[model samples]
Structures are given as structure tokens and as C-alpha cells.
Target: MRVTRPMLAVAGAAVAAAALAGCGSGGDAAAKVPPTATGSLESLAAEVKCKPNIQTDADTIRQAICTSSAGKFVLATFSTDRGQREWINEAKDYGGFYLVGRKWVAVGDDGVVTALRGTLGGDVEIGTDHHAHTGHTG
Candidate 1:
């Protein structure tokens, strides 16, 4: 068999595509936590250098109050993506900031959330204004 320029080009393109696919998370490396960070609420908290005061422990969610140098915040790990989304949706009405990971979420004020993002490697989601609920009777 004789090698050709076209065959070499095709092989190179396939290799490049495979390499990009290995990234898995849309190639956004900053949006993923380290391997050890997803094990539990405690481990995730540890990544942000917090001591968790666990508040809710259930089959669906585990939550804690954590105070790191960044400040105090709520740390929670969920059993499923749907559960996390539901909880975040409800919590957002209270008006706060969220640092979200695979199955975990951290709730705090803007500064705290910003600080947590540095160590946690997740996306920041802003909550709706709590004051919006004041005038509504229903």
C-alpha cells in the first residue's frame, strides 16, 4: 500500500477530533471540580477551606452552614440534577448568589460566591431579587 497526502490529512483530522472529544465537558475545564471535590458535602466544603455545620441530612440533599475566610455560606450536595435545580429555583427567590458544581451548590452573597468560585471551579448563578415578592399578595 502507498501512503498519500489526502490519507494523511484525514488521519490528522480524526486524531484532532478525538482529542477534543476527550474533554467531555464542552471543553470548559474551569467549570469542573477536581476529582476529590465531589465525594460529599464535607469534601466540597474542604475544597473551599470551610468547616461545615451540617443542617440538613436527607436522602435527597445534604446541606451545611460553612464559614471560610471568604465568609459564611450554605453548602449543599444533591442526589440528582433535578433535585439541585428544584432547590436552586426555590432558593433563588430569596435573592443571593450561587456557585454551582456537578451535583453541588453553594449559596452566599456576591463577595462570598466570588471568592468560593476561585477554589471551587464552578459557574456562578445569580438569584432573583427578594424584594420582588413584597408587593404580591398571592
Candidate 2:
């Protein structure tokens, strides 16, 4: 059977759709939660009823410290996914709870992060304590 251009187009579209469908959920409970907003640090902070105290505002990143009845947390937005991942990797060494969105991360105590998740609707990530990995001698 000779494949036609139309046939190839249809097949390509089908493959793309399937790939998108798989990405839609990412097979995670967090994906199911609808974020109040994404894209900007302010918007994400506002979702949790926070008046952000701007910390670092730059081309590559925008970060703020916020406080509410739930607690205080640091919210940061990155310019790229790569940047966000790198930041998270380095931050994990400090050990804390994180609520992650598309290009933003909220860092705080476990309770604060969990509460942010309820409103911000993002995945919860736990940072590893560097001390635990150290080979310390008494």
C-alpha cells in the first residue's frame, strides 16, 4: 500500500495528540489538582492570599517572601524549566518542603508548603537534609 501525504498527516496528528494526552496528567495526583494560577510569582503568591515581599527580581528569576495565617514561605519563579530544576537541586541540600508549579517553587516548613498546595495546586517535593548524607564521626 502506498502511503499518501494525507495519510502521513493524519498519523502524525494522532501521534502528537497521544503524546499530549499522556503529558496532560503525568500520572500523578498533583497533576489532577487545578492551580489557582501559574506563570508569575505574584499570581501564585496571591492565590494563597499573600502580599509578597519581593526579594530577588531579575531576568532569570523572581523571588518573594510571603506570610499569611497559614505561615511564611518563599516563592520563586524561574525563567526556564532548566533553571528551576537546577535551583531545586541546590536548594534540596538545605532540607525543606517545596510546592512546585510550572515554573515556580514555594519553599517553607512542611505545614506551610502543604497549605500552599491546597490553594496553589502544585506538587509537593521534600528536600533532603545534607547532614544525613554526611559521614560524621562522634
By TM-score, who's the top model here?
2
Q: In model 1, which regions exceed 4 Å deviation?
A: 1-37, 131-138
Per-residue accuracy of model 1 over 59-121 as CA lDDT, tens digit each: 999999999999999999999999999999999877899988889999999989877877876
lDDT of 2 by residue, 23-44 (tens): 7855464555675458688777
Clashes of 1: 0
Report the C-alpha displacement of residue 87, candidate 1, in angstroms.
0.5
| Candidate 2 residue-pair clash tally | 0
**TM values, all candidates:** 0.68, 0.70
Tell me the lDDT of model 2 at 81: 91
